[model samples]
Target: MGIPLDKAALVGLFLQTLFYGVFLTLYWLTLFVLLKKTGIQRQLLIPVGTLLLFIATAHLILEFVRALEAFVFQVNTLGADAYYSNLASPLALASLALYITQTILADGVVVWRCYMIHNRRLLVAILGCIVLLIYGTSGYYVVWSFSRTHPLGNTYISITIFYTLTMLISVSCTTLIAWRIYRTHRFIPKGLATFLPVFIVVVESGALYATSVLALLVATLTGSNAQYIMLTVIPPIVGITFCLIVLQVHFHVGGSPSEHSAKPRGILLRERGVRDTDFSNQPITVHITEETEIVQSDMMRGKNSQLDSEGVFQV
Candidate 1:
């Protein structure tokens, strides 16, 4: 018989798989609720969010399979070497393809929306075409890399460069847009502002890169099953946490105030028309005085009595 699996390793594997599944479930449920309530059917962030959810689901499935293989066969067939050489190759390629497609399309839509908002039709078309060309070329390269036997080196370099450039461009564009909105609106919604800072930190800190590096170091140095389990578990937890936070912020920002409040303030406007056309205009000033102190003309008193009878005016 091959080496028996450590009890602790088995427990960790089970818990990790369970946690991942829970995370994915929560994410999808939150996303569904947000979509229904917000009525924002199409957004760049939706695809990104979906991709993240997909990654988490796929990761959980992969881990579950590995755990089952170990438990049932009492063999280490799904070890690091097997993962890197066989399983990861195809998965990585697919992930890269999805990332490229989603990123390009999402970013293109954002750029197009920005241009349309600013009434830059000509520039929108030009920039849109350029985005398509860049994405097309990248897709071609990714397909070519996948077809080769030794695809890792070329694929890694291509994806790294593409992702780095895309991240930088996205960050710069989004920051500029946010700034423009702030300048024009004077008040950026609190949730949206919160999102920007968290997003900036996640991108700048290179959380994914750090996770990969830590995983590699752990796998190489100790070669322990516990380490392997921890490596698989931690990054997804962190990623899922961020995704949930983002979704929460989005939902909170999108919520209608009236829906949350029982007694919403109603706007009550009292207009005095100087002329027929002036009826459409708002009053320039409003003054409140005690009824005891104010003296009203007979005509004004009659108008006030009429208004009070109709319940159209209030002191």
Candidate 2:
């Protein structure tokens, strides 16, 4: 039989596949909900977002095919050499390539966030570039190792180093961003106050990914196939982390105190000798957007109320 179904490697991969499906579901569902709020039929359906979805879908498809071939077709029909060769096949290599792409893109998103939070600082950008080059080089080495006769024996050390470096970059950059946000805003909501040591980012993003990468790296170093089990789920974790950043930014709270007051209220303001603008003539979307923010102002029949709180109409 080609690698027994009950083997630790197979069982670990199976568990990972199930978790990957869960995270993949979360990614698309959250993406759709937030993007739908942007209106305009399909607003902000950007290239990076679309590419992430494509990569995730393609990865799942490849996993399904491989799983079927192993557990169904080759369950009792292959020897050891064929089993190992099957793993290093072209499709398997392509799958690893897909994972590398996903990691690069996810890391790019994290770096972009640091750039944005730091207001596009040149030094930060340069540092980010160097980190990415190192990460990419290491990632490529890991893939190349897969073609070797004994991939894990040849590459575990490098894999450990790669994930270690990855976790370091992720932790350091994320902490910097969170610290800056704290210095600027003075406080993040207590509800989102999880500033974990090495796995969390601003707004509690990316902890799962960082932690999983750490676990995978540790497993690799310990000379176990547990790393492969974690690999199946890491892509989806990366995508989910990227998606969480977008979701947090999208649902940011905005409005005045009275806008969020317990009492439902509206306002109208006018000035004497001023032309009355017909806002109703504007586009429906514009009007809808304008009305999204509740106005808290007082009406003045014949006097300027720009600073005065008299003759207020609460509608």
Q: What lDDT would each prediction earn against the true structure?
A: 0.46, 0.57
lDDT of 2 at 108: 75
The TM-scores of all predictions, comma-separated, are 0.46, 0.66
Model 2 agreement with the true structure over 253-311: per-residue lDDT tens digits: 23232333345322222334433333455543223222222222111211231111100
User: Which regions of candidate 2 deviate over 4 angstroms?
Assistant: 1-13, 33-45, 79-87, 148-154, 187-203, 252-315
Give the deviation of candidate 2 from the true structure as CA RMSD.
12.8
Candidate 2 lDDT score relative to the true structure:
0.57
Residue 172 shift from truth in candidate 1, angstroms? 2.3
In model 1, which range of ten residues has the least summed lDDT? Answer: 306-315
Question: Against the true structure, whose TM-score is highest?
Answer: 2
Q: Model 1 segments beyond 4 Å from truth?
A: 1-32, 35-56, 59-79, 86-92, 95-129, 132-136, 152-156, 187-256, 259-315
Q: Give the clash count for each candidate.
A: 0, 0
